[model samples]
Target: MPTGAAQRPSVSSPRKRRGRAGLVLLGLASLLAIRIWVMEPAVVDSDSMEPTLHPGSLVFVFKAAPQLSGIHPGDVVVFQSPQDNSMMIKRVVAVGNQTVEVRDAVLYVDGFAPDEPFVDHESIDGTHFSLRRIPPGEVFVMGDNRERSIDSRDFGTLPLSSLQGLVLGAGR
Candidate 1:
């Protein structure tokens, strides 16, 4: 080498570059798999869940939750709207074969009113729904903000197959 000449910087070999790229691809694939079969993030787009889940709230939806843990009354869940196929979030009020009714703004399951502290009763406007029996494979869901939410009262019961996931928790 000539005196005063600058030395060239070391370059990564092709094998090393390929290895790094392969690792990145593997990591991405793992994330995709988890999202598809395990869990995913969802955004609440309406005030239907009000005190429990507000509009623009970010929540974690565990896709495998239903399989691991049975869904019951008071559980928040995500599903497709039967009317327009849009995504919706609501709390399960009645399970399969359960009779649900709302009289004078009070919710009744199997003729008994369950205490729901999360409900926005002030927003309820004398809503009265006749008794409806949920099918063996369906659930009745409703929004905490009843007056503003279009839920089972409007669309009837939702099949368990339509449920996308269970809302585990909220995020900032």
Candidate 2:
């Protein structure tokens, strides 16, 4: 009995709008869950990792896995500082069972030079140092700004348990 104009669909009603809003809320909740249970946010506060990560850079760290095989060399990670319990970021230069040495400011792992293009500064002292067979469950970490960092060279190797997470990269 209604004309074509009268039969036309009306604007979305309040009920329909509520349903759409609910879906949006659900999506946001899912994202929040993932962030809380998996990745965590970290803020850089020093130039220790300069040329790679600078002060004020925001990054996300993936929580350490329960069954991690081992931390590999070249992986940027966050850990508790040995000198102090404060969290610090550094790159793994040597893993357990591997040897690390710095000779005349050049880094050598197991007698071979690593391709460390990220290092932007020479060691402050430019001296020689070595660690033979870093004990199991430990890693040697160093800062890209070697000249200004207090790392394995200063505090020695850190226990794997000290590591909190692996830095994936910068965030937007």
Candidate 3:
């Protein structure tokens, strides 16, 4: 026979612990979903995009369809390497329906010089690159640091399907 005070419920510590564990599990699940389905974070490992994106800087990509937000020239993007599935990041130099040619130390697209403020410090001299006619459904990409970048000039046009996403601005 117990009094009303003695019959009061006693809270178990295990219940609190289980509640915390459930919260942690839910947070981890959300993060996994974001990483696998939404976007991915990346770090640049080389100077290929120097002045635009430097080594060790963090970046992000959409990893969705290219037409989700159509690839535009001058937008920086990341893609699967043609040689390997490894990732590569570069600027979109020319999209489909454009021709790119290097002559007299300048880049000419469709025989007109694009006013590229980003290419000012690059060296296009004596590179001996052949003119390129960007094919449909493919894009020509290159690093802003043209002199040191391994890009379309060396690897040829990359298909739009190969692109991961446009670099979604920069990362903190």
Candidate 4:
């Protein structure tokens, strides 16, 4: 009868390695599928969403966020910039049929101010701005760092269709 060293089986077999490799590839493929069809992870690229989303912070985006619950004010979203066609992340300040205005460093939605705790206090510099009503099928977005962000204030309201998705949460 085989015993001790003579009976011991090789742990480093090619078959076992191939099985492990196949499992790893399967796991990677599953993750790729989820990212493509379910959620996508993104890195914050600018201070535009400071206080809320810092630069380099990782965030997960819902590819079908609007489908879950239609876009609304205060929802952080990613969209294509009309100015340069680059992707930008900002908070939805006003939706279609709403009025947005800046006066004395204060933001007013409709006719009243909405509590915005995520905005950078020192970044607001709304000295004087006219009231602009968001047209249908569009939204008014603003960066948390209002003063430095070139958003709707610089370009104008964005088409709702341009939005890619909403920032669901931070991390993977």
Q: For candidate 2, what is the lDDT?
A: 0.81
Residue lDDT tens for model 2, 10-72: 789999999999999999999898787667899988999887899999988887441364568
Comparing 1 and 4 by TM-score, which wins?
1
lDDT of 4 by residue, 50-135 (tens): 77888899888887877667899988888888988888998899999999998887889998988987665565654556999999
Rank by TM-score, highest first.
1, 3, 4, 2
Q: Using lDDT as the measure, which candidate wins?
A: 1
The whole-model lDDT of each prediction reads 0.87, 0.81, 0.80, 0.84
Q: For candidate 4, what is the TM-score?
A: 0.79
| 8-68: candidate 3 lDDT, tens digit per residue | 5877699898999999999999999988866889999888887778899998877663767
Give the residue spans of candidate 2 off by over 4 A: 1-28, 64-70, 121-123, 170-172
> What C-alpha lDDT does candidate 1 achieve relative to the native structure?
0.87
Error of 3 at 137 (Å): 0.6
TM-score list, all predictions? 0.85, 0.77, 0.80, 0.79
Count of backbone collisions in candidate 1: 0
Model 3 regions more than 4 Å off: 1-24, 65-67, 170-172
lDDT measured at residue 171 in model 1 versus the true structure, 0 to 100: 15
Q: In candidate 2, which residue pairs get closer than 3 Å at backbone N, Cα or C atoms, i.e. clash? A: none
Q: Give the runs in model 4 whose Cα sits over 4 Å from its true position.
A: 1-27, 120-123, 170-172
